[model samples]
Target chain A: MDAAIRFHGVGKSFKKKRVLDNISFSIPKGEVYGILGENGAGKSTMLKMMANLCLPDQGGIEVLGQKPSWELYQKIAYLSDRAKWYSDYTVEEALQYGKNFYPDFQMDRAEELVEFFKLDRRLLGKEMSKGQEARLQFLLCFSRDVELMLLDEPFSGIDLITREKMIELIIESIMERKLTLVITTHEIDEVEGLLNRVSFVKDTKIVVEGEVEELRLKSGSLKELYREVYA
Target chain B: METRVVGSYRFILDFSQPIYEQLVQQFRQMLAKGEIELGSKLPSVRDFAVQMKINPSTVVRAYQELERDGLCEKRRGQGTFITSSADQVAGLRREMAENALESFVEVLKILGVTQEEAQKMIAGVEWK
Candidate 1:
């Protein structure tokens, strides 16, 4: 299987505090992989490294078989909880921004997603609720025809319906496109059935990693495995 | 645990087990019992995955296994359909019954039931 993303002996530090230590994993092409951990467990750091938002202090990382760079950004859609919108930018303006920036961004698909998510076209980013903001963020990310999508904590602070819609969109995208998706999330149950593989990051290390169904057969549900490891 | 209705088949899944295996097992049981009508069109892999909130590959695997077992067949452009052969359905029914009896006998043996006692117990059941 071709690897869409690979990390070899990767390490990261923040002000001399070890954040990730010798972490290594590879996501195969078209696989839905999950990065799971409690807050500050270096889950986001790993995703950011994949997206080239941050650099690893040591070792190397590969995205789509090549090193992450501005050129490779065209094939990757990276979405985090970080605010990408201007405070005053309306939903319509944000769609325009996506169109202007991402060459692969499909305006028609964005319009359809906007309708599916029931987002108000005139709603300003600052005026949107958490769930609404998440929907908008997902719309922007999902509309792009990128081969790899790195979503960091996509379900955080969203309502149940919003999460369901987001998941539906994720599932639809996977079925429609041959996409390799890497999502960092604490919402395990929501994404459990969707993930082909998962890794549990604890104290700057990958304590557990395997195919979801294989691990479940040995250790029960992914939720139970997490509890057993983190408890 | 999650319950989903795909086509005429009602799926109550055990998440601890591999989803594709559970789906294939359910389809087998349903086919044996004639619950899933012969020649009925099964849900497309994508539609079933979306409906069940599971990965499409899981559905594809299950469908493939069913096809391999002769419980279903996928026609190129048209979609998968349940086996229309009564002989195949009967064979599955007999296979399932044998499996059930094998496990039941094993349980009786574990309980220290002799062959004669097990036979007596089997005879004591009221046939419906």
Candidate 2:
């Protein structure tokens, strides 16, 4: 029952707009946690704090049994819409770059993954279609053996088929590495099955959170509850 | 590797009943029907979750239930496999059949028909 992440009243505000307010939840190791909400639900902001990309205005947050810091960032593979480190890198080059950037990055596995996904080696990260790019991004992220993997809106722009591919690959990687994943998305239907647990963020805080089955049994499906809360 | 389907089948969500219960019941039926052969490898929790489009944790619970029932066993680092013991499979099959028969008898009682009448009705069913 080791905790991969723990947030104690974590709060953040951006330019007078409070994005998060006392958000508290703990994610256990080797679990697929879904951070779910609608648009402007502070999901991204909370993820930024975990990635050490943003400083929380108040409260404490712990990732991988330690405070958020640059060293901790090294152990976290964050997938976000943040600036691409090397969008111009070809599929092959991305692996080379990822290897140099993350010591745990597995170039051999990355090559295998790209081939498995049938992603062309010649296509640059910036040149691939949105779906192709998403698949590449997921492959590159999973190449690193990190304690925690954070995904922000993983299927936002991808097509249905590509999203399915991404989900399959993600599961394969999680099972192989026993990685802890925290994925944020507004699309409830897409992630209902992949998540081990779920936290429904509303009005700048977590209004509901629990293991998916328990919550579904106690209340109802996440989609129905999410609709009721957001409606 | 990447696109591998460790579990093959779509799981349609049933909101009225607990998902893990549904999953366990489905796997049990598959076991009784020999849809999944004895000693076969069951899919990993995450892979089954993706296939069913349900939470991975729920799949874990279902696998745990299967283990509790002596239906499946998880090998360290190898994965979960169906029970190898013949007695265990036979017991499960008998349990499933009895449960089905119980429900059938209950429906017959509600229909105001006896087992004798049910037998005649079964015999009367066209075999074409």
The candidate maximizing TM-score is 1
Write model 1 residue lDDT over A41-125, tens digit each, in one string: 9999999888888999999999998998978877799888785554689999999999999999999999999999999999999
Per-candidate clashes, comma-separated: 0, 3
Stretches of candidate 1 exceeding 4 Å from the true structure: none
List where candidate 2 sits over 4 angstroms from the true fold. B1-17, B33-61, B72-128
**CAPRI rating of model 1:** medium
**Overall local distance difference test of candidate 2:** 0.83
lDDT of 2 at B104: 90
| DockQ in order | 0.72, 0.40
Put down candidate 2 lDDT per residue, A1-231, tens digits, no spaces. Answer: 799889998888889999999888899999999999988999988888889999888999888889999999998989986657657789888888889889999888898888877899888877778888888888888888877899998889789988888887777776677789999999876776677788989999899988877787778777888988899
- Which one wins on DockQ? 1
Candidate 2 TM-score restricted to chain A = 0.96
lDDT score for residue B86 of model 1 = 91
Candidate 1 local lDDT, residue A42: 97
